[model samples]
Target chain A: MVRQERALRTREALIESAATVFDRDGFSVASLAAISSLAGVSNGALHFHFSNKAGVADAVEQAASERLERLVAAHGEAVGSALQMLVDTSHRLARRLGEDVVLRAGFELSRDHVRQGGRDLYRQWHAWVEEALKRAEGEGALNGIAPEQVASSVVAATTGFEVLGARDPKWLSRRTVTRFWQLLLPQLATPPVLGSLVAAGGPPGDHARRTPGGSPAARAGEEDD
Target chain B: MVRQERALRTREALIESAATVFDRDGFSVASLAAISSLAGVSNGALHFHFSNKAGVADAVEQAASERLERLVAAHGEAVGSALQMLVDTSHRLARRLGEDVVLRAGFELSRDHVRQGGRDLYRQWHAWVEEALKRAEGEGALNGIAPEQVASSVVAATTGFEVLGARDPKWLSRRTVTRFWQLLLPQLATPPVLGSLVAAGGPPGDHARRTPGGSPAARAGEEDD
Candidate 1:
């Protein structure tokens, strides 16, 4: 059991390191040597966990996909209305993306042309947004506009925020997202549903806060010491 | 005069070739040899025109910027209201970006981390959208929403369309953009202004149509025949 746990830790470390390097250097230029060095693992250990650079990237993308799934599921369970869920989820996503290098790198990799065929995190996110909007439409939450149109707009704007946030972190800030929701909610919700919707949603906890060493992998490494 | 014209044609060919390769291979992996070969120009001619790949990228960006400026200016002259101009310009841009390799390459390079300290086409587009929104607000064309908030939403959505369009040309279709405006315009414009606003805008000319060999540089090459 102890050996399994150690193996898992090493895998996590490698994934995090790969994400950091990929986020900084981009997938085309990111090197396995740099990833292993950052993870504090031997070259042999890196190869043991993953066969090649693409394998490392796949692992990072898989980890990010799992986190995104959990985030969506958690929000799905908590919110009463689909529109409110979307509003709250957008806020949460922007916050998490700001703080999580793995998530950010996964998204960057999705848009990247170099890596062919993996879990496309953006498409996954877009699918969820589309599903939520359809649910909202069924519930009579939306105004006269078609659900698909709203879905397209929401997906585009959120993706924009993600793209721009790379250069300026402010694009992913809670305030910026809140403002976006404020402007959009009025246009999106029906008059009856509009009164109940909260554009800001609930406050995110300390986990959502930005930190210098932000990834869960980094925090786990700290615990070992 | 003939010599100067030939030199200009060679420069255009190199820029077009660079945009095509950069769009396909991305900045990091793109090579001068590939660009020169695609342009059908000698390596000597390529070097004479551009010091390096970055210089080639800068020239493509510069050309894209000029086209964007001309697009905005043309719309500004044709439309009476700032809001109308915004709508018309957006439709034109989506169409142009779909047809123009240089414009698409310029935007992709703007978000690319490999290159730095060039004209950020996205930022330039965002600034223009912001200015238009502010002008619309001054004209009392906007509803209750703040111009800044609308600007943020518009910029994000439009940028989203640009980014997503890279993968799916449908994202840049006139129908998609028109639907976006149809959904947004009612919420954005005052009831009085809403009545006058056209969601589809005027039809784009044949020049805006997608072609296999679309770039003006390619057309200029054809003229030589």
Candidate 2:
């Protein structure tokens, strides 16, 4: 049991290290030696767990996928409409991408040609958005706009935030995303359903931290771009 | 005069070669030797033209900026609404991105952290969109939607398509972009002005090749994504 636990922890550490390097240098130029060293693991151990750099990237993608799944699941169980859940998920995701290097790297690596056959996180996320929108439609929560169009817009905007945040971390701030939702939700929701959705991003709890523009008043210890 | 012309041609060739390399291998990994060899120029000649890799990137960015300037100017002169000009420019820019390696490379290099203080094409483009939307507002072409909000959506979607197209060229195709505009214009244009906008992208002349999905029907000569 002790050995098993140690092995799992080592794997997690290596994946995190690989994500850091991949995120910094991009997948094509990132090296396994850098990843292993960053993880503080031996060369032999790095090889024993993953065959190569692609393997390490796959592990990172897998971890990120699991994390995303958990995030979706948690938000999916929201008490109100699925549309609200979708909006909350987008806000939560923007926050996660800001804070989590592994999550960001998962997206970056998925775009790289080096990791052929690895999970295409972008497509997966897009499909998930579509599903959520479809559920919203079924619930009669959507307005006159087609769910696909809304899904495309949401996916594009969220994906754009991730890409822009790569250079300017401010793009991923809650305020920026909130502003995005603020403009979009009005058009997306019918007059009857409009009151239920939170354009500031999340439910009442999260609204306190995220203002209309998405600026957090005094949140400290957050890393800069 | 002949020698001066030769030098100018060599400089242009070197910059083109550098763009191809930088676009393919990225800025950090691209080698100056490869660029010189690809241009069929001597190492001394290449160095004489540009001091180093950053210099080469700067040259490429300058060329791309010129191209973008010409494109924006051509579209900006439209006799109709500024909103229409904005739409036409997006279509034209998307097309240029598909065909122009230097333009695409300029954007990629701008995103790269190594090329700090290089021309931020994304910011430049974003600012341009804001200006165009402002013009639209001045012309009363805009609906009730905030120009800033519309600018954000347009910039994010256009940028997203460019980034997505890097991996799957289809995302950058004329059809995909046209569909984007088709979905967006209804929300952007005032009721009286909606009829004037071309959701299929550009004026009738430019729409000859593009279908709804961007599939090229028998244009064998055109480059595939």
Predicted model with the maximum TM-score: 1
Task: Give per-model CA RMSD.
Answer: 9.0, 5.9
Q: Is the docking of candidate 2 incorrect, acceptable, medium or high quality?
A: acceptable
- Per-model lDDT: 0.79, 0.76
Model 2 CA deviation exceeding 4 Å by range? A114-117, A143-145, A205-209, A212-225, B205-225
Best by lDDT: 1
Per-residue CA lDDT of model 1 for B1-225, tens digit only, reads: 999999999999999999999999898989999999999999999999999988999998888888888877786455567887898788789888888999999899888886883788887888888899988999999886677777877888888889999989878876566666766777688888877776666434523453332222321001111
Error of 1 at B17 (Å): 0.4
Give candidate 1 misplaced runs (Cα > 4 Å): A203-225, B203-225
Interface RMSD of the candidates, in order: 7.3, 5.5
Return the TM-score for each candidate structure: 0.89, 0.87
